[model samples]
Target chain A: MSPSDSLAATGEDQLVSLLTQNLPQSARTLHGPGDDCAVLQNHDSSSLTLFKTDCLVAGIHFTMDTDPARVGAKALNRTISDIAAMGGQPSEALVTLALPPDLPLSWPLGLYKGLRNAARRSHTGIAGGETSSLPKGAPPVISIALLGSVAPPHLVLRSTGQPSHIIAVTGRLGGSLAGHHLDFKPRLAEAQWLAAHGPPSAMMDLSDGLAKDLPRLAAASRTGWHLLPDSIRRHRRCSIHQALSDGEDYELLATFPPDLWPDLSAAWRLQFPKVPLTAIGTLTNPDIKSPPLSGGWDHFS
Target chain B: MSPSDSLAATGEDQLVSLLTQNLPQSARTLHGPGDDCAVLQNHDSSSLTLFKTDCLVAGIHFTMDTDPARVGAKALNRTISDIAAMGGQPSEALVTLALPPDLPLSWPLGLYKGLRNAARRSHTGIAGGETSSLPKGAPPVISIALLGSVAPPHLVLRSTGQPSHIIAVTGRLGGSLAGHHLDFKPRLAEAQWLAAHGPPSAMMDLSDGLAKDLPRLAAASRTGWHLLPDSIRRHRRCSIHQALSDGEDYELLATFPPDLWPDLSAAWRLQFPKVPLTAIGTLTNPDIKSPPLSGGWDHFS
Candidate 1:
């Protein structure tokens, strides 16, 4: 294979799309791939099962010297964030770790402590996990697969946004690597509150920033977006560009009907007074061109 | 931490024990942490859900030059084998990949082809997955998490074996690394047949060779094993030691009541004539001393 055909050149988004296209789907699969979580038909007609998997690799997600507890927390929280994006309640999780043999026992012990604490806080049970040896010089890799459930009527999906829907985000974006990536709580409660009251037309977590993720949501819903640049909320001291491009901001990016925005915003203010819900844009017709966006995190970049 | 306190010094077994101790469990958890798969209560009281996660790391499970297709098959098959051990039917899977950016995109495409073929044959759906980049020079890692289900009456567990139960294994054992490790079919059909006919007292897949895994089955059931060395059925031309320690056999090892052996063997021969079912040992009282057996795969050793 030539250098141009390498994964680096193909990029994460294109590679994932190429690999997952026309993959297997069963009668039980409510929705597969492309969404934040895969939705599966459950025995109970009233709810559906949500399945997702994610990984955190050292040198990419964290350094060897980083606090092991936070590393563990981040690993589980990332997957939980996917569940939260679907307006689901996390039920159980299985973890897998590939570690270099020379790592101290204390590292994994601290990691498990964090994992246990995080699972407890989310009401998710840590069902089981396995550990294996990595190559001599390789860094540790932590992977988690989580199972969650959502009531059929409340399950939100990225492919349901409509033209003219008001686009909004929960909390500030950008500058997540300055410790927020490791510490930000998933918007599980806030999402559940929205689902219980009245779910938005579409919803997803902004892990890869608005520049990349918003486009994905738009593509999935067969719509375009018109961003209000001045309304895009930024983290403390972050610029508008950074707010649009910097990834790892685990905030909810959702769309609501224009008619429901007034009541939804008022109710959200009363429910989660501490977290900011900022309306930043509106969905547009698919033919309407969106402003070019760049600089969001890309793994193979 | 001292060198003696490293994970290599503690061994994989001890390390897993240290990390998984007292993990949180919920009302829906039927079994957690020790079985081949974690069993969770499903909506239908007649059946339960089985969840498991396993990973194949580069340099550990396979080398860079190894066929990407085989690597992909092995990754999914390994986790599917876990569900089969519990007499369950594979349902859906989520795959996560960590790859070095410079690797050719063709590698992942081939891997996905293999994954799709395996899922098709196993009647499993590919729900969804995530991909991330590994550091430069790092090899690729593929991790799979599978969800399966088993009828309540047919559920099998390693912890339920009894003294005097006849221990039998499906097919030959050991020397798997020669070629079988990559191509051996998981005994899903055979296990489900057994469950439908007469469930085993206890069962598990032999991934870490009989010497290690049999002891685990015994330990879990509070029993001991008495092996009939002459009766062990080894792969063609494999020595007794290799048959006992090569690991990655991916065959079912099960314990049955002595009284049911004749009828069960007769029925199994008619059901799966090509597959050999050999009775190799019997469970002994936990306090009884048996011949010391050693040599099995251990990750950190």
Candidate 2:
């Protein structure tokens, strides 16, 4: 078996298509497979019930050369980002570490330190995990299973956008190659804000770059997307490709009703004065003749 | 990683054992790693909570030739056994399946179906699970997590036996190599019965053969055990080794006060006429030594 991206190696489109094709109704699951989190109905929590498992492969996800703490932070951050996409607040986490016997004690401790610190900052608990020592040659694999809860009516998902909904982004893009990927925040507060006030429809995190991830959310919602390329490229001033395809931005992409555009910007600007939420595009009724955002990542094909 | 039994291969035991040697107190957890279930205080629960997790690897635990349904049943039953060891009723289960794409989908479906059947028989809910395909060439692994409940304070555990406790077992043992390993019940009912009525001081399921697992329970309680080899062998008309080590009998093992023995057996006879609860041995406060039951199956070791 390969990562979800690998399925796309046959082509990214096919991977996403296959993911949703055979999904069981999962009635017990208020928000199922397609969303960043699975949701449950709770009057106390309009929040989406976020659940995600992210595995960090030694070679693919990170190398030993990477700082142990940063590696740990990255793992937790990635899972948090998934919950963030659905506007959920993380409540608990489980970290399963599969390490080779040769790894020094300092390594895992560093990783744990990083995880513990981040959990503290996020106000979430690292509930528990399993630790295993693989054979000498086995790669270190760390998998994090996170559970989060979000307010229901405020639960923003990737498949709720519609044609004519304007696309927007929270915070600037690009420059993750400089190591921001390992240091990024989960955008939890921003997501909660969006859910409470504007409550944008069709939301997701920009991890594999907006260019790749945007199209995914768009296609899932079965709507075409239009972007103001100049606006995005102009703000970053970096190579447009970096702004488009460079992954791990950890920003939020959301769609909003045309009438709420001003309030969306005003509210975003008022709250996170420094982190700008910029309008990037509009959703259109998709057709066989058109595609949403842009191409995406594929592993196997 | 090497299996759990391969503790010395990587100098990890110094650390793993160190972390586990003396457990930290948790206000919520009734039983930690030393027992099959990590019992928690569920204030509203009219019953005791029992939780456990077990993992199955492709090459290590089972192979493609093994029936997929059996694999599924094994995963679920292993966890159920954990609860049974605590004299608890099975409540709910969740499965996490990590597969290789090369394997047939039919296998996974069969596993799901079999697991569902097992859960149904246990009268537990299929809470749902997260499924993912691992990186290419990774062995297929299945892990089942279970949640169960027993009458509060009646949940028997490994560390509670007394020196004067009388050892007892339910049902006959041996001949399990005849496919009993693949289709074993958790002995949940017998466990509950003993927990509530027999007044057992300690209880656990005989899974890793009586020899290996019984020692583990004894060690946890810091007690010594004296086995009745003749009595055990006579009951089954099998070799002492077969009676002691031929495992997967899935029998309920418990210890109680000597005076309770007659009533316990009589009650068991009335409640489950087909299964007899008979005395086997007694706990000892002294450094008692008995022959090893037999190292039944520690493949890696």
Candidate 3:
């Protein structure tokens, strides 16, 4: 079979793997391709540049009836969340919009309003963008590339977890489809606090749900996970399975040393009183197989 | 009429005006929107960051018969050309691809290979990207966001031209549709040499043809331009009208002090013996009534 046929047979995961496996790494590239953000050395040696890009398609991410402003807000928020995941400060963004030729002016205007509002809240500037007309019947597509920076000492990555680390998450999970995904604030401040205090060994935003994302962290760290289902916090009316696989939670999942759990929990409560920070699992030896959980989401699936 | 209807009534230019009219500008922003790239302050304090984004839709940028690698290379080259226009060195790029649901894996792989190859030649790294499946029947779209840096003193802007300055362009223009658009290199080296020597008072790439883009530089500089039609360079067998209106030439358009023209031309010939660098016009007083030229490509026209 041709590469195309084999790719179609295998799916999106394989496609992503094939696309990224052999990219040339530059001298300044500290982390490339596999992380939430590509980390690069800034001309200023004090900080590292964080680069990330994400896309939101109208049909897949939201319906036409969804508020245009929320659509805009979610577009920027998704990339902002990635920066937050890296314990970085989002500084600028470039937005690219592809719309059907007949899209109403108000719709795009409202979207920009939402984007501007969210960007202001996050202290990020929308520096530039490109707007184009797609084919007559295509849906609107929004893609944002966000740039950020973090002090090297405060930076976090999913690959740094250890076998004995306790897994903790901030905020409830699941039912993001009920509007939480569009409105949740990126945990930028919380991440900075964690990096300064608890100093997570590993960290990432809960974009694809606990079940799907936990495995990524585990795989990155070359470990496995042992989740205590009862300890997992869920939104009211959501099941453990739903909490584990609904995705788009926009919460923070992190690993802390077992001994630091008490001090970390205390500090988190004091720092973010309304947000719940719960310990739900522990990193384990890779050889220990845990119960299988449903995957959160796959764009091509 | 609804906002959409009114927007359709007013057209793309009006829509662009509405979208950019009141955008919040940050303190670090040196130039925002309205240019080939947005300029921002680098933390290093010695240089400025150049940010630009451009998108290529299948039907708009290329056809199915177009090589997939060329499609990929063109996507990156578009933004690299923007950086070159600003006299900067491209350092990183983030690519976002939206492919048809059943696109052969070979297609996207070929596209990435082209993108990687071009990025390598330009000294840019493919740092990160997002991939998604377009709705059934929708065409492929590729968007790229490029980042670069330039010494503060070497920076160029389209709005900095002065009356009496000579207008010059590097390389031939027009007939890009015949395949030059897909294969042409962004004038990165020529731009750097010009910035270091002639130090253009104003600069921008000729993406939307000379007739259309010259007026942009004129409007931004608050001046008018008097192009000597006989002096304009054209691709082999291309007419003067085609040379003036055919977009996607990807050549550098710049202004230099009339006193420096002889030296600039001599140095340019020595530096790029194969690429033609021709002076075709002079910036004029804004009140001058130069012959009107037709506008170039508009996304929603």
User: Chain A TM-score for each candidate, in the given order?
Assistant: 0.97, 0.89, 0.97
Of 1 and 3, the candidate ranking higher by DockQ: 1
Docking class of 1: medium
Which residue ranges in model 3 land beyond 4 Å of their true spot? A6-8, B6-9
lDDT of 3 by residue, B91-203 (tens): 98888988766777788889999999999999898987888777777778898988899998889899999999999988887899999989999999999888889899999
Give RMSD to native, each candidate. 1.4, 5.6, 1.7
Q: Residue B242 of candidate 3: its Cα lDDT?
A: 85
Clashing pairs in 3: A104-B4
- The residue-by-residue lDDT of candidate 2 on A51-117, one tens digit each, is 6666666655567899889988898888788787887887666555656555666677678778877
Report the poorest 10 consecutive residues by lDDT, candidate 2 chain B: B1-10
Q: Give each prediction's DockQ, rounded to 2 decimals.
A: 0.70, 0.16, 0.63
Task: Tell me what TM-score chain B of candidate 2 gets against the true chain B.
Answer: 0.88
TM-score of each: 0.98, 0.75, 0.97
Q: What TM-score, to 2 decimals, does candidate 1 have? A: 0.98
Over the stretch B1-301, how does candidate 1's per-residue lDDT look in tens digits?
A: 3434888898887888788889998679999999999999987788899999999998888877888888888899999999999999999999999999988988999889889989999999999999989999886778899999999989999999999999999999878878899887899999999877868999999999998888889989999989887788999999888888999999999999999999999999999999999998899999753656777888876
By DockQ, the best candidate is: 1
Worst 10 residues of 3 chain A by lDDT: A1-10
